[model samples]
Target: MKNSDQTFSLQDISPKGLERSRKLTHLISSEIGATRQQVIPFDRFMSLALYADSLGYYVAGQEIFGAKGDFVTAPESGDLFGFCIAEQCAEILDENDVAITEFGAGTGALADTIIRYFDGKISVDNFNYSIIEPSPHLSQRQKIRLSKINSRLADKIKWYTTCPSEGFFGVAIANEVFDAMPAKRFTIQRGEIKELGVAYDGENFIWEIIECSVIPELIRDQMSNYPEGYTTEHVETQGIWFEQFKKFMKRGILLVADYGYVNQDFFHLDRCDGTLRCYFKHHLNDNPFFAVGLQDITTSVNFSYLAECALSAGFAVDGFTSQAKFLIGNKLGDHIATLSVGDSVDAYRVAQEAKRLILPSQMGESFKFMACSYRLEKNMSGFADNERFRLG
Candidate 1:
């Protein structure tokens, strides 16, 4: 756990933030009260904390990306990440009437960068860029930022609250998206599985144990071989989400980039505490009860489980590799080569960003890229080297 001591202080919160947090807490408490057990599953708690009507973290109109937000994503670092992704998209884009749908387009930075890079480069006549953004606040921000593009590129952008059930073909990108989806938490105690739920204590929310009978059989199969008091998360929603894609998507690839691990590492005996984490103003901690609506809660993805979902959805595992390898194979060095040595300041800036992106000690190994395709013929160039195996 990084920054375990980064606890939240009520005195440090602004009056407006404090008010919002209180309102959201009250809302959640009211819902819990309505329940017969006066408790709710952790996934339900997470959904309300992060995606409730108007008071949730995402839809509450808060600064949520880049330096001013709770955390910075790859696109916020620099255009290099987007440029590399754009190159990969260009390579996979085959049909004439194809489109690109990016799930959770945070700040629209990647969309802007990719579209700018694709201008005149993608020879497809009917190229469209669709963004499936759930938050109206973030959608407005994306519109403002993306509106600056030229008319030709600007016309290619569209927004939706959900993936179109009609489906399309081309590509789907989800960068740091699945980590935010609500996940169920459970623990093993005395050789018995128990659910970890949320309950209101009049003052704050606290953990409550429940029967594990409610957990699905699929999740139960994975909970074995763990010692007592071992806690972990399960995001069954990932598979459900994949099923939606399988039904709607005609034929295309889904690209996912997030910080996570394979099943062996994720469920290792040493990992007793699991990967659930909270972020507030760049600070990280294991506690999720503090500053409820003001903090960002996330759990590391189980890549092996994700791969299984892809396979069950009829999508072949096109590739899986570390972000470092994906970027290198996708020509990250080509972007570095464009830098002019004469301009030391500009060259240094790009070099620093590249280092942060691909260095082993930085975002490189922590983050991974997985591509699942349906009816795609060729392998993705970005994951040609060092393709991972033993995925579920």
Candidate 2:
């Protein structure tokens, strides 16, 4: 579909445009059963943000990374991040005999970088590579990018529509994947925390904080520990993903890198607005009602909650740290110094960008790394011994 048919343009932000947005909002609210007096629950809100037909961001085919995209990811920073990750993957493969599966392989940039790194660093004859990408557009892109490497290695790259079952041993990596899962939003009013529900407001779309008195006992049980007046957002799909992960991997390492905080940090009084965001053409848009399905909507992951979920699913926590500490622990500086020896300025520029990715002020501090092991007996490689930190 053309951008004009689905997304809001500059003109769409005007009075008439606002009217159009209202109409669209009304349509969505009616579909989701939201009301104007209440806030639409976060999970339903996220469903609209991510999967609202062709209008949803991920389904809309908007440019998502690089200068032309909505935002830049670490893989787009350069090959170094992928190379370093590949080094870690090699360590995992060295210790266990299993294949490598990467989830949500956006643009296949990371896969290309990883394949190149593996080709140069290890013998490909012994290992298999797989990618679980639900987006056909990205899967096609990955196929094209991986073609530059040896065809034999490229052939080892398998694609799965969903995560595999019965568990395989190896490394499973997800970069910026969990944050995209649809989440439920709630707010505290009159000292009662209520779920925000979506509904039509006749002229426009509006939110309603409906009393979820009929919510499943299991879900209610999970929320029993929430303190009074503690309004927060929850990714209802997170636990489902964790269960899938456990079923898919018998014994291997699971690496996840994303921007999020622990429970105490995320649920503090200052975080009432939650971490919802929309990105379009490298710009951040706070109003989800404006763009409909054209912008990427995401919220920060709650790492502490994620860790607990993983543990409940039978995975042992390996390590958790900021990207900066993780890279420094893995000796990123040495890699930069080695790459800088080349005469090409392009190579040097790439190295500099890689440095920026790991710098404290940029993605380094904001992004975090978490590793979980399932049935692995040995310590996973990549970081110095002293760099390891407890998740709790």
The most accurate candidate by TM-score is 1
For each candidate, the alpha-carbon lDDT, in order, equals 0.86, 0.70
True-structure RMSD, every candidate: 1.9, 5.3
What global local distance difference test value does model 1 have?
0.86
Q: Model 1 over residues 1-392: C-alpha lDDT tens digits?
A: 23586865878788999999999999999999998888999999999999998899999988877778889898998788998998888788864654789999989999988887877755546679999999998899899999988747667788999878786888899999999999999898788778888998999888888753477664578677668888899998988999887876888888999999998889887888999999898888888888989989999989998998899888988788999999988889988777535488888888998999999999999899999989876667898874567565
Any runs in candidate 1 off by more than 4 Å, and if so which? 1-3, 95-98, 339-342
Q: After aligning candidate 1 to the native by TM-score, how far in Å is the CA of 178 from where it should be?
A: 0.7
Best by lDDT: 1
* Predicted candidate 2 versus true structure: per-residue lDDT over 62-138, tens digit per residue: 56668977788988877778877876776667723437889998888888877776664545576678899876666
